[model samples]
Target: MHIISGHHHISMLSKDAKLNNHFYQQVLGLRRVKKTVNQDDPSMYHLFFGDMSGNAGTELTFFEMPNIGSTVRGSNAITQIGLLVPSYESLVYWKERFERLAVKHGEITTYAGRDALHFEDQEGLRMVLQNNNGEKVPDTWQAWTGSDVDPRHLILGMGTIEITVRHLNRLANTLTELFGYVEAYHSDNEAIYQSVDGQSFGEILIKQDLGPREKPGKGSIHHLAIRAKNEEELRYWEEAVKERGFYTSGIVDRFYFKSLYFRESNGILFEIATDGPGFTTDSSIDELGKDLSLPPFLEGRRSEIEKNLLPID
Candidate 1:
């Protein structure tokens, strides 16, 4: 059986944490759900933005890299993020809001049969706001009423993530055969796949490109994480990936959830992360992202870590 649920989160690189926070939280209306440091590099900040309460499928995270260079556009990398808006009318609402706020965005267009508005963040992180057309699937995402945008038009969660790769068959096989994603649509060089559950939150769009490998930098997506039900499912995926001759990170304790990382043949990093204990494990829902949080292993060094990082505010 396919253990993957939907997107757990997508992590990217950012040059300035404060500006990134403002663009996503104030301008885009996502809530800052966590303030923490990169698990591997404690000196840098890791921020998570999502629906209110930081549900699994809604998270968009970033690792602050103050000196990072510009991303070199190319293939074999995550190219764009897709966020879900409630309806086509919501797209119009966002378009006007983007103009009033001076946010860079394109005209509304159809993508995989859904109306979409493409936009870029301050650091040039590309994203599309796709109208979900009011899909009635059950979800955990909560609208942050504190946001400037109306709750009805608030971004519900992440949708289709676009990945550009040279070897389409190899990556497609990994997604379909390994991860159990089923192809839902295809045209020209692009194809859309959805998880077994067929939710909009679980879709992926693959673009075939024979260009050079992407040089990741500020605004470049680091990895796409899919949901695993729990630690047991995470372990199952680790062995499955390893048995398939792929290198796996094994089960990793991420505090909020367990995770396992592996790079598919096309060089795109994929992470299988658990759904809980979610962001609320450490901080209460009301107090999330108010202060820096550290896992138990890093708690002892919190002072030193905080000293090296700039405050998001």
Candidate 2:
């Protein structure tokens, strides 16, 4: 029952890889760390970007499909993807930037016991930025490099990716039973389940009566990842996840870490992934994503795969 840590990453489906990359890289300022294909759907690209090290909570991934099926949003679709920052005051700074940049935005306020701002990416993915008191992350500021980003004012963790769920009790029970989340707090509209570890990691809020599921459309979260300390813990999760009635994927080794996938009763895909052998596994800490690192099984196809992909760096 030791749920090793918090979120490892979250994946969303994108209709346009180039536009998606542009928004995330330029607007959000996150670094693209890996470019590959979906293991299950190799025809589509899997793009990963986050903090400098691709740390546990810093990961934001995408499955690039310009022609993906039409998406719809309703209950069960991830509502807002939140990123936690330690800087409460810099929120004003971000506000100015958002305004100056002229990206569509909305008001700021205290949503879940924290000061927060709500906005959307170009693709219309709802995003929330909140001040996490003082929790900080390790990624270097490559996005707004000269723009007064204080690590002390750094992102604490990923803010809860808001999700719409039906039969809250069933999903709630499953979360408590299978995953390790507990009822941390609740707002006037939703119950917030947070990691006992006090992070945006694993924090989820089930908004009451968000209503029935719809087809996922542009700007919807495809899945979210939970951390499994290592192979042993992941194996435990594989069994536990099965016993609870969610069928999980057989172990799949990503070059940086390993993973097992399953879905919560609520239909949101969940991945239990390892945190070790990070992006540094293939290249020096200085050279991640400079070149492709293939698993032995795919080594022979490296030149071919590299050739088919879009240029990142």
Candidate 3:
């Protein structure tokens, strides 16, 4: 079984939609590719922000669930997310640029067999820069050079997602059996299970700890997604997930991609998503984010949804 070819996406809960919008689109140079409400909960905005082309790996999405309580960081929830760069030179460029701009960053270090640097966003959302050699699914990321960036040379999927979990083995098995991942290697405190081909963009590492599970809230991970090459693969995944008796959701359209959600045995919320009907679904390259487009199911409530969200830009 293929454990999915690429890193489809990552979801985060944001307290301020507008602020998250500006930082990701204007500051980080990501394109506000789509605007819509959360499928599960229609009141909140589900925003997709990624590189110019909205490729699978480069996406950084947010759910404007501003009312969720503040987070108390711990294991069980994804602690920090990492974006893999092309090479060490790219990593160095980011480090220097963040420093020059006074972006708070931790000292650089080697991690999980790669060189890395860590930092947080304005809302204290943890993120990292990684330079690692691994197998990558084909992608298109238009670097935020403003004037132009050839999408062909864009970064691949997310480098890794660090989850501080109390349960290790169950999560490992879930990924392996259902998602096509295998035990690649391990650290003293964490086991690394990756797609057999070294699709290292998405990883589940456990920092063992004993405590109550983290409550989902602001600054917390909403979900981790795996890429299915197409709906046919995604259909196979839904069957595979249900066979394990997991709580899996029906396919939900997200304009750019389709998705199915389930809680893995390790208790982390995960998704299997298709890679088609991408960013150009509703609007042209120049018209993205100019309007909030929703699936047929949620378009009726757009006005009320607009009023509830605090203005960000």
Winner by lDDT: 1
Q: Which tens-of-lDDT digit does each residue in 107-200 have in candidate 1?
A: 9998767899999998889999999987854357787777788877998888989999998878888888888888998777888888855577
What overall lDDT goes with each candidate model?
0.89, 0.72, 0.73
Q: Which pairs clash in the backbone of model 1?
A: none
Clashing residue pairs in all predictions, respectively, total 0, 7, 6
- Compared with the true structure, model 1 gives a TM-score of 0.98
Give the range where candidate 2 is weakest over 10 consecutive residues by summed lDDT. Answer: 138-147
Full-model lDDT, candidate 3: 0.73
Candidate 2 lDDT, 1-313, residue by residue in tens: 5774667889888888778877776666666677667766555677777777677777888887777665667786567788876577857667777898887777778766678888887777888888776564434323223223444444445777677777567667777777778888765557878654465656877775556686886677888887888988888888898898888887888867899988787787888899877877666756654455566667777777767777644
Return the TM-score for each candidate structure: 0.98, 0.89, 0.89
Segments of candidate 3 deviating more than 4 angstroms: 132-137, 147-157
Model 2: number of backbone collisions? 7
